[model samples]
Target: MILKRLQSIGMVFLFLFGLLLFPIRSHADSAAYVIDETGVFTSDQLLELNDLAEQVTNDRECGVYVVITKNMHGYSERDFAEGLFFNYDLGYGLKDNPSGIILAIDYNDRFYDVYSYGAAGDTFTTARLDSLNDLVYDYLVKDDWFGACKAFINKCDELLESTGYVYHTIQYTDPTIAPHIVETSPEQRRNEFLLRLPFAALGSSIVGGISVMVMRGRNKRTGLAKNADQYIVNNGVRLTQSRDMFINRTRSVTRIQRDTGGGGHGGGGHSYHSSGGTHSSGGRHF
Candidate 1:
């Protein structure tokens, strides 16, 4: 009886130990946003991008997916992209009205597509999606997978910000936020202001002193005209009956072109497949 009890206790301890050694898999592993089957990105690069993509998806409550496949699997780039999003259940939000965006690329065919669903479709405008593709193309052409992925992530972050989505975990400094002026911490700004205060004061003093001296010299050189008529020319000023005349009023109208989101001259647009999935896609031969 003693031996049997000891055995049971040891079995319970072993069971608890097994739980720690073999932890349950996270949803990230199952619903990975970055699927680089072509091995374009290194393991480290893939891990980094996956973390970024997952965070953006969660924050936006919308998906931002990327798939780098070896082939199109018998479907066009656009169709394949939409099918992948649908099949893999890649979106978030309501089941009937899921929201997400996907970027599918086939390195073998040099084809790529960017598509949005539900809320993401509304957030990522057609023009912005095409513009994003244009931005990523520069790196794709150079075979810089990591660079392209980074660009895509950064662009998505910016678009989300436009829709009032703020990312706090990682701070990415955008120079365009405040052009020419570099951002500084409070202490740095105060130190800089203090350092420049003396020079600013000196410059102001010099300018003020020069103006005062000039005004004093002018005062010394001239006396206020004792009489207004004394300084006036006899017929220097003449006023004729010149009524305010309006010669043909001219009006110029500028036609502010609206962005149709058909991608610019060489840009692309979104299309729908038979399944009713919308796709905003663009690509070129590398």
Candidate 2:
């Protein structure tokens, strides 16, 4: 039996050695967020973006992914992006809702899409995705691939923060909950503040000037009788007893035209290109 024991130990040793020689890529690894199949990003960039995505995913409880591929692999832009998300099983937690958002880039095809699934879909509504699509497209048009991915992560974080976890939690748990509405972003708010800033400044300046004048007027210590008679100079005192008459009033009406055309944002929604999966994407062709 000594020979049999030696054979078994030899097999065990080989198995252990093989594991060391070939390490498997697990989901727990650090670079799970940014998957670059095209070799577009350097090691340092991948790590940095991966960390950012991971932190956002954890804080938001929804995955944020940036997936770059050479081409769509013989599939349409929408099909390929959704397919990758599913086939890769990319998401957070093993729950029913494998909620995640993907910014898929097809470098060869000159096309890109921001796909959102499960709870992420509910949170990243069409309007928000459109905004992100526009933001990323600006970078991609300039061949700023790294900038696009970086901006994608940062914007996702910003959007998620504004809505809190309402979309991620409420929708998944109770379908009856009122949907989360991402009405405004920090950028939009800042723009509004800027628009009103000039008016605000003007009002403040006027108030300040008036206050100063009032203070100066109060400090003059007026001696009424000294100069009042000389200061009041009337240029020809002539009075005619005439009454002013009222004239007829005329009114002009201008018709206000209405625009029947819908907004650009109406083109997006929760679409199910195929069963077993659903996503929201306003694909951009740059």
Candidate 3:
């Protein structure tokens, strides 16, 4: 009975192993092409990156082919640099080169790089170097394929303004100024004037008060001038001195009045006054 129990245990272990292997085999079959150069990447590392690309392309419905060069013989350092130049050049030629994205790894340097060519008008820039590295390492290396591809595309947009690579065409639209200028009928103008009447009356009242103050000041000066002659007679002051004082006070009052009321009226009934006698005054009001 002990021997029979041992046989049963063995059978149970075999069954579990088969179950686990079945899913893995099925997954391997469904994945897109996964090329790994044994010299460049260990079998385990290749499998890991393959699984990552598979998961991402499957989710995003994108065609992804992962190529790994194990030995420098078939894919040397010169070969890789030429490959990048070729891809960039070809993309420029075909104008559709940005669709293919490459994730290249330099095992010697322990660093990886991602190059993407987005749609037309989208080009690469130096500013995106760091972000592209982050997307490849953080997302692609982590098997977040969908996130990596999306982030790559977004990085392209972020680089557009700073890239200095102008697209094929400049999009322009005519300025729409007609909407800003509305044609109002006589009735509308009357209504607009009525709407502004209260403010206009307030402004007029202010102006009238200012005018009254100015007139009162003039009247005071006139009275002072009349009394100046009396002072000259009583205090022995000169007539020339009295006349000069009256003229200077009148000139000051005129300047103040001009400063308070000299600009055009607009939608608002507030008057805009300028301090300078010349048209190019220091202040302006609308």
What's the TM-score of each model vs. the native? 0.51, 0.54, 0.26
- Determine the C-alpha RMSD for candidate 3 after optimal superposition of all C-alphas: 34.1
Question: Which scores higher on lDDT, 1 or 2?
Answer: 2
Pitting candidate 1 against candidate 3, the one with the higher TM-score is 1
Q: Cα lDDT of model 3 overall?
A: 0.40
Q: Which candidate wins on TM-score?
A: 2
Best-fitting candidate, scored by lDDT: 2
lDDT of 3 by residue, 1-286 (tens): 9999989987996786566446544544632334433344455655665576555443432323343332222333323422432222322222322233344444333334444332222333223444555655676455454354445544543454355444232121222111211233232344466556557657877998999999889877433344545445565754565433434433333433456654542333321112100011111110
Ranking by lDDT: 2, 1, 3
Native-to-model Cα distance after best TM-score fit, residue 61 in candidate 2, in Å: 0.6
Clashes of each: 0, 0, 5
| Full-model lDDT for every candidate | 0.67, 0.71, 0.40
Which residue runs does candidate 1 get wrong by more than 4 Å?
1-31, 165-277
Clashing pairs in 3: 37-68, 37-70, 39-70, 40-70, 98-117
Candidate 3, residue 180: how far the Cα is off, in Å: 54
Candidate 3, which ten residues in sequence have the lowest lDDT sum?
276-285
